[model samples]
Target: MAGSRFVGHIKMWFFFVPLLSVALMPAAPDPSLFDIPDAEAASVASSLGEVRTADAIDTTNRTFKHYFVATGLVQASMASSGETQIEDGGVANFASRWVHNFWRLVYRMVYRITVMKYWLLGMLVFGIAMFTDGTVRRKVRAAAAGYVSPLSFHLAGHGILLVFGVTFTVLIAPLPLIAPYWLAIAACLGALLWKAASTYQ
Candidate 1:
């Protein structure tokens, strides 16, 4: 009876040992080669355009010209706005002092509430806009090679600012009690410009 019991115990151990070993073994990782999609690879290659065996210098000249023209337009617009404030006198000094002090107070209050919180918020908003505009430009460029320009992004940003500025100005201008609200449109435009310049960079 003892020998029969020992043999049964040995048989059970042998059966479970194989099962435990199998369970303990780690699974083989899937191969990475299968991860690449054919369509994605084709899309990437298409975006780069064809590389020429020759210098291909003249081929890209048009792109350079377009970039220069777009940049020049932005520069001209900024210059025309007198944003540099070349002529500064009593009125300009007074306005500058008040605006500067007001913004400083606003910044201090915002910072006290949360360190660099508004800066981060502005950055996040700008990033989203940049991404959206870039995607649009990419699609436009894909459809027509010369359609993409830096001005397109600038115009899009300005258009967004203009819409909000006009809306606020119109809404408040109608209220006789708040005549000063009309002036807020200019303030909003200035704030938008400052935000656009700083945030985009």
Candidate 2:
């Protein structure tokens, strides 16, 4: 009874969402809603605390870098040992270069991670859903198998992407929301919820 009731609610959504979208067809949101200029990428970064960085250092000075200094110390040790043999010097030089490159790579990776920390965090949420008991994965995969024909499959695939892309862009980015956008989002949500409910049956 509860599953049927849930499905009934989903069906109701299918009706109401389209009705609401049609009602909104004549006009987009008022300018007061879309006029916020600070809703750009900078604001997103600021909200994630990425834009508020530590004081800038003298990046031009390569020798001042920890990686470079570490390699320099290795080279100095080689020279101080009076090891003039070509083979031994070559090994030391190779080790120094390897250490230098490794640390430099680590530093760059860390810097980029800090810049995109919020993006990574958001993706991890999706990752958790994807890797969990496989309910979401199984439902989507079963739905995928139902799209047999090339035209139907590809069209549905692209339509799903377009709906999600448009919804996300309008919601997260500073963009004008349109009626068709809401219709698309609602239709997708209704269909997915209906499919999920049918699984319980």
**lDDT scores for all predictions?**
0.38, 0.41
Indicate which candidate wins on lDDT: 2
Judging by TM-score against the true structure, name the best candidate.
Answer: 2
Tens digits of per-residue lDDT for model 1, 1-201? 647744444444444443443333212122222222344334323432345201122333333345544567434533443334466555544443333333233222222222122133545565566556655646655667553445644654665445443432322121121213323533454444443433342
TM-score for predicted model 2 compared with the true structure: 0.27
Distance from true location, Cα of 197 in model 2, Å: 13
Candidate 2, residues 52-163, lDDT tens digits: the string is: 4331112313333555565676456445544245777465555444444433333333333333343445444543443353446446756787432344434444444444
Ten consecutive residues with minimal summed lDDT in candidate 2? Answer: 54-63
Instruction: Please list all clashing residue pairs in model 2, or write none if there are none.
Output: none
